[model samples]
Target: MTMCPQCGSTFLQPLRCEAKGSDVLLVELRCSECQTWTKAPHTRADMKELDRQQAEFRATIVDGYERSVAESMEALATCFGHALELDLVTADDFRPRTASA
Candidate 1:
């Protein structure tokens, strides 16, 4: 019987198994009360696969962030150009407004 480290509960539920490349099974257990997670023994292939998945997820997030920044920059440039063409250029226009003002 496994006990929860935080709450000392004896009810530890088996969540799932993360298996990779055969001969690699990691059993995850969660405490019913505190929601603390514990992992069983894992092989080298399991660790490698987990690392690879993490790297891929991080790369995807970065790609999305870069795309959003590029789109925002393009929009800002377009707005600035339009403002310039309309002769609405003013030093005060670029200044940030304060909540008090």
Candidate 2:
């Protein structure tokens, strides 16, 4: 993974990729987090490794988002349980109201 020299972020995206000839690639990378730009040379193997690392980062972010959503759902359930215990919710609250001026 290419790291941003400024903020140390490894989530750099490719702004451009060009052939340097003879098994070399010239890649222009921009950091997603810090907007830092860099140009570097890489082999095909290095590009593959960078792709793998980027996938790992994507998975990590998705996992964190899922965990956060699950926690929020649990907390909301607990809140509703408390509200029910306190009789804060009534049948009338679920009743449909007719539109009026």
Residue clash pairs of candidate 2: none
lDDT of 2 by residue, 10-75 (tens): 888988899988889999889989888889898888888889998999999999999999999999
- Top lDDT hit: 2
What lDDT does each candidate get?
Answer: 0.75, 0.89
Model 1, span 4-90: residue lDDT tens: 667988556667776654686776768878899987766756545655655776799899999999999999999999999999988
Index of the highest-TM-score prediction: 2
TM-score of each: 0.55, 0.79
Q: Candidate 2, which ten residues in sequence have the lowest lDDT sum?
A: 1-10
Clashes (backbone N, CA, C under 3 Å), per candidate, total: 0, 0
Candidate 1 whole-model C-alpha lDDT, 0 to 1: 0.75
Q: Cα lDDT for residue 50, model 2?
A: 83
User: Weakest 10 consecutive residues, lDDT, candidate 1?
Assistant: 45-54
